[model samples]
Target: MPLLLAFLFVSATVWVTRQAAAARTLTFLMTISTVVTLGLIAFFLFAEAIPVFERMGVRILLPLEGEMWDPNTNTFSLVPMIWGTAITTIVAILVAGPLGVAGALFISEIAPEQVREIVKPGVEILAGIPSIVYGFIGFTIINPYVSSELSTGFGALLPIGVVIGFMALPTVVSVAEDAISTVPESMKSGALAMGATDWQTMKSVTVPAAFSGISAAVLLGLGRAIGETMAATVMIAHVKELPQPAYDVFDSGETLTTLIAGNFGPAVGTEYLLSALFAAGVVLFLIVTAISITSQYIEERMKRKLGGEV
Candidate 1:
């Protein structure tokens, strides 16, 4: 029996290594299986979400006049959370976008080879750090700074958004740098030959050519910002209303992700409250999905464009 098991394992390994067709077929099956899990997730979210809609109608998503999202009074509004998500994402993108692009440009184009070697790996290392570390940092340091300096209170959006933006930076830098690096050297040479400086060539020839990929990187960062939960939850307050002024980022509030995450434990078997959280999950899922799909599409376009296929 031991000999038979060893033989089977060895034969399977040989089959996997030697047979390209079999290996590819197995990999394809694995990939398709992952798609099935994604489908299941979508199904579960909607399954859990639709009940809230049925019970409270669509107005549950819109802002109501009184206490927003009070499960006790049966008042369930999602607008405040939605607003929080939107504003935080916007601020994150704004903070991360230019800095990430600049970092990418410097590493891929301007930095010395030694500097690039050091900086690129360092930047990549940031991505490996856990989100909870970011949350703790925000909860401990940034939260207090913002509350004291900006008069925004403990859970203000400015600090939360900025922290989230830095969290998204590695993705933006990695993607954008790859895109910028793909620009043909000949393009830069041509621009330089036409009396453009290194800076001008980079601005005119490299950056413009790689703009689609950079845009995709920004969108990817947007997706990250939209989906961030733990950091925002730790950094934000459980404010149950929309900010008094619609555009106020300083006002403390919970995002949809934070709302669901903060409530999931307490909401166990609490019918409408559980449903409400799931409803928030549904909206969060859709927004993140749309941003990811759009980012992917743009990345594909960038690849095609860079390859001269488009």
Candidate 2:
């Protein structure tokens, strides 16, 4: 009997080692594929955009002043669109960050087990809903409300920011909940045994322990808001110029993603216009890429720290 048990144990060890090696190989291959794909995309974007600089000179599109993106007038300043993207993204993050983290904490720590199961799926379902549907809701419901209450036209920046913030909420909550769940149960138990209240344990122990993951989730949400297109295009007033005070959230404006999606088809006929749009694409790409890289780095660092590899 003893020999039979030893033989089974050895067999299980061998099987587990084989599986681990296969997983490592698969991960390496996937990493290489992703890097190669991103490199190709970057190369193509630059190749398409270089022509605009050559034909019109960088001064035409990049001048800080006298830069209006009037295609008819041959002016292609991107400052307004850039500012619009920044404002909308910043506002969305500010709104989504706290709500998402709180929702995550509720599900992971405060909720009953059965309730957590129900709420988690609902949050994930929100992420799966089409972006265009969210846009439609924003256009039909949010726009009218803002227009009526604020006595402003539809497509104001505040409504767009709020809508995008909602769109990003599911992503932040899902990721943050997963992170909070990964915290060791023993830590929570120890805190409670040491006379800490449930809320105190969660606030001091679980949240701080999972801070990196929560931050990564927020950054990911920000990236999603920054790159949203159809929703922003439909909901935003789509003004091509900057707001009067430049910080006015009540004014309508354009983002890079919205600008590219809305204008790419019509601009295709003109080489310089197409190239200029490609330049905008490059900018959006770089921003999203940077956010993604930062999120990934933080996640990896957190994993290492949790695994005691740091």
Candidate 3:
């Protein structure tokens, strides 16, 4: 509906401009509508968010200093879930970053036109696949393989990480491909004309030119991996205890999203449960927002370095 209204407004603005003497009015209307839309969205997110935190003792902020998450015990430390979410996202991004960049490079720089056309569609199709399908695939295929080959028990994290890496792959590929493709062709041609190797040109010049976009893509992928609930829920063992010191990659851990999803139904209407879920949400929001802000800052810095902006 927002998009439809945007399109209709644009059409009306164009029509008014064509008629003469009404362009200013149309522009004013467009500005007002855009502000009103943004204000409404902000109001909604903030309104619900306040109550959610209020119930969770957010004003007192006890969860930060507490030890356990059990509500009946009045223990509500969020460190474990926070650690799990951070570690999983970090591991998944480490795996996905290089692979996603390589995939994007192949599509944007190396593949022949015909091959690119064929492969691009397949990559886009991956993004269209349902999250539940990925979850089922992770649970049925990846989980058992990890449990059998990696350890005698507690081998779920590795599979969930891999599944998340796969799930975020399409986003990274699509976004990074656009970034790589946007690199000035003249720069590539100049490097090639100077007798530089294809790999050298890509590594030293093209990728540097596209670094901001690649970073943005990576941040977006990390956001998706961090917020993913169903695949993690299905694939992970949903361990309640803190992960052991061994730090086995195969061991399962509960992330913030999985923790909330697993507990919400049973804890409904209970202030503790409601507050806990909201706290998780608040944490997720902060993490994603941080990523976005960092991406924008990097983008701005890169633009300045590249002289795209000053």
User: What's the TM-score of every candidate structure?
Assistant: 0.90, 0.87, 0.83
Report the lDDT tens digits of candidate 2 across residue range 60-149: 345356547767756677778889999999899988899999999999998999998899999999999899999999999999998999
Measured with C-alpha atoms, the lDDT of residue 110 in candidate 3 is 93
Worst 10 residues of 1 by lDDT: 21-30
- The local distance difference test score of each candidate is 0.88, 0.87, 0.79
> What ranking of all candidate models by TM-score puts the best one first?
1, 2, 3
Give the CA lDDT, 0 to 100, for residue 88 in model 3: 76
- Clash pairs detected, candidate 2: 155-237
The residue-by-residue lDDT of candidate 3 on 57-159, one tens digit each, is: 5432332443456677545656667767767787788778889999999999899999999998999899889888999988787777777786635436767
Give stretches of model 3 more than 4 Å off. 1-67, 152-155, 308-310
User: What does candidate 2 score on TM?
Assistant: 0.87
Model 1 segments beyond 4 Å from truth? Answer: 1-18, 300-310
Using TM-score as the measure, which candidate wins? 1
Candidate 2 overall lDDT versus native? 0.87
- Candidate with maximal lDDT: 1
Q: Is candidate 1 or candidate 2 better by lDDT?
A: 1
